[model samples]
Target: MTDKQVLPKVTKITAQKRQGRYNVFLDDHYAFPISEDVMIKFRIFKGMEIDDQLQAKILAADDVSKAYTRALAFLSGHLRTEKEIKQKLQENEIPETTIEATLKKLRGLNLVNDLQYAGSYVRTMARTSDKGPIVIRRNLRAKGVLENDIDEGLREYPEEQQVENGVEIAEKLSHRYRRDPVSKMKQKVRQGLMTKGFSGDVITQILAKTHFEMNPELEDEKLQNEFTKVWHRNRRYPFMQRKLRTKRTLYSKGFQSDDINRLLDQQVDSQ
Candidate 1:
């Protein structure tokens, strides 16, 4: 049509060594290569007529086909949401238009479903991980899942399961803080549960039912360790100042007043 002719005649097509790819010839010269997906989409074959516009369209479609193959590889490990797929493509520096086209293909094939993704994530984390409802919801939201889908996912997590997990977590925390007073231990457990995303009601239930009992010998040993450290550190001060400082330090550490006074008395007598 114009002085600058579109140089393509689809002279021959042949399979490449790489799976799912082929080499195409035009005007009996080596032309562009295409994926099998592109070949099928365009019905490209030997001797097919191709103008400049068709050539450009084929190249763009091939771009999407390559990105689609990459997206499928990204999805091979586990199910992913649409946002995840987009992010993967973006990470690989795929073009925006190609990314959108690939996403359309994935959706058409029912491979990317946020609703199912969220629901499955909720179920898996609730059972396998220490993450609670609030944490799991935040995680899903961070992945750009819709709020409605998040809420639907949380439906798979029951309140009874929440309470059970809360109680188990509280018991472990109580043991960890066993050297502290029971009241202080409860405070630590409550704070730990909150950090782990347990609801206030579940924490309250755990505190009400679980009994945190520290052995008397362990408490005595803990008191000795604290008393030694404080008394020695305050040795540079006056004797009276040292005694007062030691008692205050022990008391603030959840040591019983009577136990602290007895330990301080023994220390003063030893000096």
Candidate 2:
């Protein structure tokens, strides 16, 4: 008898818990599970006759369908670069041919365009994160996006916008360092912006825009509060030793030498 003539008949098709997937039974025995896309593509149904050749085609189609489904799931929550998708499929041990077919299918549907992914990623990072263009480019490259696409994406984030974002970040940080010396505050702001991927030029522009202005009243108040605490803590020391200790403590707290000396002199005059 010919293989086609002796082929088994599908007895049932059972829906699996996973959405859009079904288990096919041949001659009352479990044959294979396939995605809805595959079922529709192959016209699979209960009572269908599946020859050995047809069964092979169905299994191959199922592999591609599963890979495509996985790719869709990966892309559902967030955009992914082509390289990222390939890596994900490889990690799942999907065959290279199947991966290629799945990716082609995705491309055909216009669902996996790197340019679109890059543009969206850049915009989201600019709006939400502190990352600069240079860092953003490197990140996109790592995700397998082409340099041209990266450049296209980065074009959306202009230098002026980066400076603005840097200034905004610096302003928020200034509140935490209000009591610190002007030099210390500027240094901290510069370092913070640098870590957030801003270039030196952008950081310079931001610092220039958000220049630190010392409030003498606030400085004096903070110094006095700090001096009182230091004084009580070093009450056991002699006056000169206590003064030296307090000056060092204030210096360590980011107060300038002049401010520390002036505050110490005021304490001595008062006592």
Candidate 3:
């Protein structure tokens, strides 16, 4: 009887390079194409090829690339803090090792910065309206900003400077409201400034300093000046009725109650 020969089944496929490196594969899946020199250095057999080991290394590199691409796509849509980006990657079930590798690449590119992002966010919100430090701090904290960074950003503007900004707004608005009773006009201006994100204390201080009192002797001259400003605003008011509506308009602007009544009474008294 002839002796039967037993041969091991080769399941893994490894690529061998004549000059550079060989391509490795597993069950029709390409793993990695390792260099010939690297293979020789590791004593990976030149003639005796192993598929199992080659498959493992290739799979690891594939996983890392996949995780990195996912993170890159997310950052393209919106700016994300490092913590936020990491959390998102992890939620997707990406390996921790992959996450670290991806974040390192992102950092090298300068694509993510928590500090700079927080500063721009604060400035934008501040411009929209005068949100106090309390609201601003809460917002930055929620975004994963460090406490020290928040402190530095907020400290850029002192309390006095913020109040001064409010005063400027009040002054510009006050010009249109001169016809309203001084007391009432001041109240309206205060409300306008407050709604604009000016602090209450700042609004009070501005009103106290710039009194918006009514002076009847100067009414005609003030009315002409006020009318010219309103007209220049690009509104075409019939000369007669325009004056009446302007009075009402001023009242709605936060003019004091007494100012409205006095102005109406005076207009009638004159007619």
Candidate 4:
């Protein structure tokens, strides 16, 4: 009769000093350490036969268990997109296979949902931030969300809220650029709102409602201040050159050509 070889058996399972780790002894020799969750998941027990193939499978399971635990910690603070989580897991040197497995499990649990993430992000930014729908869309794209999901999320940001946000931003900008010429101020406010991601129609609406018109006395004061600055800035030039430079600069500053010429004539007459 041929003698059969006995498999290496788990002689004992001892708790490690760590909160949720254990050491497994095979045939009275220390074989490996594993997480408690992994131990429970694989039904690891003393007297369990651990052949080479079973050991490999058990270790693989532990790797995924560890990766899953880490992923959960990453999600403890805030909701994350798949790309963001993958990048983080890669940074931690988790294997691509293990990362994918962890992601699949998380997705199954609905913990890493792009659609939900996008909608929540849009609603938050629309309500709490100055970000417009376009800006939020761009942000979601950078986070690797799909277009359909982004569209679904943007539904939370209604046009009414957009217009209200636009009004607030435009009014703030109008005040910030109040010293600018009415035309210049309007131009600045328009460009500012556009850069802030306000739609063209919304910006137009904001401009129509916002009071950019200042008193004539205030306008004259602003023109005088600008003219004084321009005049002094060109003082080193000849009289003709100085007047020409001031007129050109003031005209470019959104002052009327006629007003600029009148100011130049006044300066010349005064000199």
Candidate 5:
């Protein structure tokens, strides 16, 4: 038998408490170090016990690489909920144990957060469009975010504020539909707000308060102007037949039954 002594390379040892566990890193990689007593027990009874730092480093690199790759894939797209990131990692064939560990690491770093993502998403969409809580919740749920996280993220804003948001969106649409008679203009604005995902109640309340400065009475005079604005902006359909097709267009915007009937009747009278 050859006589040889094996010693750990003692590359670089750093210690910290990660997720309440003593995590040891060697040469900037994972290192698994058994207690000296355990090593002696194995050496004496198990004939010979071998410990290799290189092997530990290899395993650690694999785990690190997986977690990192998953993070990059998620960040490459829109900001993702924690659940979305985890599911993507799982779909990519990551083991359950590794997924959990990696997720924990990401959470510790504040890189994967459902609530933060949800809050930011809602805020951005609210600013850019008129989407309400229902659409926001639906989108977040599709991303696999927890309901509690979504609820909490949106809880800070009063639900009634959605009506105010609806009003703002309606105001933005006013310039486009203002020329239609008051009845048709209101219907158009109402429908546009509703389709953006605002609740019926919020849409109604907001529509009741909103008024376009350019059109005080919102009568046929303003209606014609607003219709001209939208029609001219999008020359897709022949201008001659555009008003004839406005009923369906207004419906698609989300106008209510009463609003649609009143607007159609007024348009008929005006014709």
Candidate 6:
């Protein structure tokens, strides 16, 4: 058949209930539906003739246009890594070829930049959370950010700033544990900072700056309070057993050995 005779003539175009999409009828039979973008791109109109070649071209264009629109919608809410965007599109069952083309389009517009996404993520976490470089790096890696991008992102957080942040957190924890023995309080702060992703060196540096002054009056009060509790709990034990148990308890609680001995001597003298 000649090309003109074989071609289907567009008889009607009607808008579907879906926003910005229309159905095209050829020879009074529904042929295909296309997005407004595709219709405009190919200048599809009633009374136009479409051969098989034109029909294939239009269908391909429509697929790409739809995929691009879906991608745009996905990106509208927040920044996303390239892998995240790909996984999202795949979840929607978009064809692989269309997904690749859509990604290319997004990259061309600088909308799918992994480096930029990583930077934004790092800055947001640094500003809003107590996360250190290790934790932030792990988070970015989980989100499929590239190693180079993650490194670049971490570079934005200076070493001094990390130490400063660590010290700030340590100070807060120190206040909470103020009643505890100095060694116990420092250990608690160190462990707390470690859980928040601070490196050992940074934690050590912060701890080095921390000063736990020996308060003789306060230490005496704390020791007496602890001794009273221990005496009550172990009152039924023999004299030697109760003394040894109290010594062990106070030592484990991080009180100084000399302080424990002096307190024990005072208790013995009183008895």
Q: Write the residue-wise lDDT of candidate 4 on 45-85 in tens digits.
A: 98999899988888888888788888899999899999999
Model 4 misplaced stretches (Cα beyond 4 Å): 235-244, 269-271
lDDT (C-alpha, whole model) for all candidates: 0.87, 0.86, 0.64, 0.88, 0.63, 0.86
Rank candidates, lDDT, best first.
Answer: 4, 1, 2, 6, 3, 5
TM for every model, in the order presented, reads: 0.84, 0.71, 0.46, 0.91, 0.55, 0.84
Worst lDDT run of 10 residues, candidate 3, spans: 4-13
List residue ranges in candidate 5 displaced over 4 A.
1-61, 69-79, 87-97, 212-271
Arrange candidates by TM-score, descending. Answer: 4, 1, 6, 2, 5, 3
161-242, model 3: which lDDT tens digit per residue? 6666566667777787766645556777877776655567766777766645457756545544554565345346554565
**What does the lDDT read for residue 131 in candidate 3?**
64
Query: How many residue pairs collide in each prediction?
Result: 0, 0, 8, 0, 8, 0
Cα displacement (angstroms), candidate 1, residue 3, comes to 13
lDDT tens string, model 1, 123-220?
99888877778899889988989999999989998888887877778899999988777667888999898888878887788678777886788778
**Model 5 lDDT tens row, 1-271:** 9878754343443333432123334444555543333233333222223257544544554565556656766778577777777778878788777777777777887877888888888777766766787788888899888899888767644566787777778888887875555566677787787677777877778888898554445453444454455445545655446544664555454434454455445543223
Q: lDDT of model 6 at residue 225?
A: 89
Screening candidate 5 with a backbone cut-off below 3 angstroms (N, C-alpha, C), the clashing residue pairs are 179-222, 179-223, 179-224, 179-225, 179-226, 180-223, 191-253, 191-254
Score candidate 4 by TM-score against the native. 0.91
Q: What is candidate 3's CA lDDT for residue 6?
A: 36
Clashing pairs in 1: none
Each prediction's RMSD to truth:
3.2, 4.6, 9.4, 2.1, 10.1, 3.1
* Model 6 spans > 4 angstroms off: 1-5, 16-19, 51-57, 210-216, 269-271
